[model samples]
Target: MKFFIIILLFCLPTTLLAAEFKVSGYGSIVGGKVLSGQKDPAGEVEFQVDFYDYAYYDEDWAWDKESKVALQLVASINERLDATIQLVAKAADEWSPDIDWFYLTYKLNDASKIMAGRRMLPMYYFSEYMEVGFAYPWIRPPANLYWWEITQFNGLTYLYNFELGNWDFDFSAFFGKETQTKIKSHDFWRNRGGYYFPPEGVYISGTADVTWSDIMGVNLAAANDWLDIRASYFSTRYTTTSDIMFFDEIDTNGDGIADTVIERRTNPDGTPIRSGQWSLTDFDLSFYGLGGSMYFTYATVLFDYNYVTYDDGYGSRFPTFYISAVYNHDTWQPYVGISQAKLKITRDFDGFGTGEAEEHQIMTLGLRYNVMPGAALKFELNKFKDKGDRSPWYDFSYHNDATLFSVALDFIF
Candidate 1:
């Protein structure tokens, strides 16, 4: 990887001389430890390192979970056209480089433009800069609100910028599609006698192909000397097809060959098991967000609220909100934030049996120190409380509360 980067750096000057090209990069080296938490009563506290899902945290000062590096190259093609390519290396994937954004921008007018190719989905105020730690006030964004299955879409976007009565509006309409594959382990079968079965856990791999049609969104914001306000609304029709494979190797019948097994869904009391996979074809999801910030000489206050709902009545209605304050003193900035989320699943569809609701709250305190011209150091402490039943996707045995401590060095060049 170092060699690859060196080669790119050496060739960048030549490219810049030939064409209007610019290169920039950002990276973060982060380490974190879980002070306390466990999923099961007898289970030991361990770090939850989920790279694909950014909500999880690292424990024991591990670097191969949250660290990442990104490089972006923008090339101007004539006066009205430009191309950008961004590559990212994440610790969760062993630092393997992946293309995050590769797009072409065509200027239609002074205030209107068109973009084509793979780009980030503008789901939140910080969506475009979510990977850049320096752009935010915390070690990371609030996980309760930022967690999503998709981050990027491959398609086209039309953006128009205009001023409306002393307020600036950035309106965008996008059409895109995305496909993702996720792999995880699950407890396939449990013994009635409370005995551990052979191969206690089975790996379940699934692929989700989603198509987004008629996706549209608008963002409006205005700022005065000390106040800023913004609101966004996005709606889309989502169609998805999924296939799952359960790697079950148990020879329950003592036969010479393994038997095909299907997943069983049970009620909260673990009775009346139903067989087969849960799948959804076409659905709709709408997102709404409102946020603002108040700035003073040395202190700032920020607050945001977001709500999401699915087309199917059985799907959960999720609402999240956060409030934070930061004080800036020279090169050091100290901040504290509180965030909460509520998940309420409407139990109307029989396809989704026995929906469970969950509630969570988190408090974070952190400090950021500008170490140098293009680098910053940060330390953060987070306390998480799970107030309700565990979400289906999360571990069933998670504790009620957990504490985490993290420190990171972020840089942009």
Candidate 2:
């Protein structure tokens, strides 16, 4: 399906391309590696020791993780109507093409417009240009705050631009829903050594059928000469049904009963079992953010703070913030930032010896050089530290500090 779209994009008539249609593209060739980190000799734990790993870097100095190219087509359907289609190919997906945006916009007036189709969720200040690396000052946005399962939605949005006093205001409201499938793994019942009954460790893998519905969001921003301020609120109801399969289990210490009672699809005697369904239904999740940046003649100061809450009795509240200062010198820019993410988990549902809180701090120094028109080169080094309990989601065996380095060539045309 995606290949067909790519072919169709290039097969358009030359007259239309020259007259009423505009075609443009952007791309990035990014590579990074973990410079220093802890190595788990047991080989059972996978830690997010670097930004590259967090971005799914699979090889040393490879462009197959955060590298991507996107082509966009904009056409004027009428005096007040326009159509846009954006197709993206990402190295992380084996260079498979996907439709990033296919939307129609109608101008309601000089200050208002309405759009319908697939579009980015305006949940943050940079949500609209999150994937356009050339538009941001950092090699990547603050991952701890911007990370989420869903980035886009298929629905409708209304935006209005207005000015009050000396401030220019942009307000947007959107309604949408999304459905996605995700694979998750855990190693709760086994330690480093693969021991016990099955002898492969009590590792479990599962497919989660997750859906976000009743999604509603509103974003407002006001900007003037030197100050830009933005705030956003988003709420959604989510449901997930998981089908988990356990790979190994054991009866250690010669006990007649199994020490772990994980759900499985079949019994040891080859009889079918039906007890591996886990569901989180109609849970409420909300995100709130308020932050902005200050612009100066030779330097820029950026800051943002965000909070997320989940209401499934796990008592999950995530609060994160980052502050950065960038100095601009001709075509070169150097920046430094400090950020922190703290997760407060009040419910110890697993009964393990894990604590109720986890925190991570990061310090980053980077330089960006505008090599030419619509092109930039970036180099960044990051120092990361983990504090408190291990994260259950990543199966990190222990707390460790690490350093990461990355470089990328970002371009738009």
Candidate 3:
């Protein structure tokens, strides 16, 4: 964070000194907590949503989980070329600044453009402005549908805009790979595999790195005055690895009972040891998404759906979706939504597929008050219920049916 903050301080202002530079920023000061910990009969005390494992909540309120700030810089080098850079710092990762958007776009015509560099992957309706909390009525994006942590890629993209009768269309396609060298992958599921049995919640302090390569995808969005629709598809070669050892119970007969111990790593004397490592390489995975929104006089209705599948069956066959409705009033917005996620199938090193059709849903109620232009104050309540017997996806897997409260001050500058 210090390193990126140094760049933001020293580099952004220097770019602004150029003749065609423009600067802007956005941020969210948010706090949230788990309210129903006692209601969790098993006494698991912490909670976290998908992908953001680094940030979580417990019985006490915490601001560090989701607060963040970002600065954006745009420079028009020439009439046909432009450079954009956005640096974001998240409190959860100790204020580490991420180079979220460091891309250059070249205008081919009034309606077509091409870009190369780093940018957010267009997976959802609000992907481009995901970090700008003031843009959305809710405190954050819906967790179930927006679960993946790999939110961006470094590559080249082409975009075209056009009109077809009553609707406007945005067409975009991209091919690239993630620039992050390592990502946490296998730890979440393995810790929950031994449901209703002993030895659950295996704690292993190590890295489970996931990599995506040869990525190609397309997004198409169409909108009119009152309605909009979007669809996207992506295919990539996924690889996962870890340098540590992996351990699990043997259940070869699929009897849901441990017959023996499975070991992959050995010590110097040939004794087995590990920290939960699995190797799954060169597998093809794909994502499918669809979304629609309808605007009425007093209310807006929205739905988003996503599905992910792996051809090798080593990855999680995840499908998630959500629907929401927001009521707009004078300086006030109230919303309600339901979101769900299903892990149809996911495998571990010992053939212990923990998230085997593991399912969960969240119901949310939130209100947004416009504090002023470019700012808003929001309150939200969410009820999380796990439908599967395994556990809620978190560092600890003993809790279920948790409720959380959140408050936030969001602004743009």
**Model 3 TM-score (2 dp):** 0.81
Model 1 scores worst on lDDT over the 10 consecutive residues at: 188-197
RMSD of each: 7.9, 5.7, 6.1
Q: What TM-score, to 2 decimals, does candidate 1 have?
A: 0.77
Report, for every candidate in turn, its global Cα lDDT versus the true structure.
0.70, 0.71, 0.75
- For model 1, the stretches where C-alpha displacement exceeds 4 angstroms are 1-18, 40-55, 164-166, 183-214, 237-277, 280-282, 313-315, 350-356, 389-400
Provide TM-scores for the models: 0.77, 0.81, 0.81
- Model 3 lDDT at residue 249: 69
Off by over 4 Å in 3: 1-18, 38-43, 179-205, 243-277, 280-282, 314-316, 346-356, 389-399
lDDT-sorted candidate list, best first: 3, 2, 1
Cα lDDT of model 3 by residue, 45-95, tens digit: 555643633455678889988899999988887788788889999886689
Provide the lowest-lDDT 10-residue window in model 3. 194-203
lDDT of 2 by residue, 50-93 (tens): 23123533225566777899999988766787778899998866
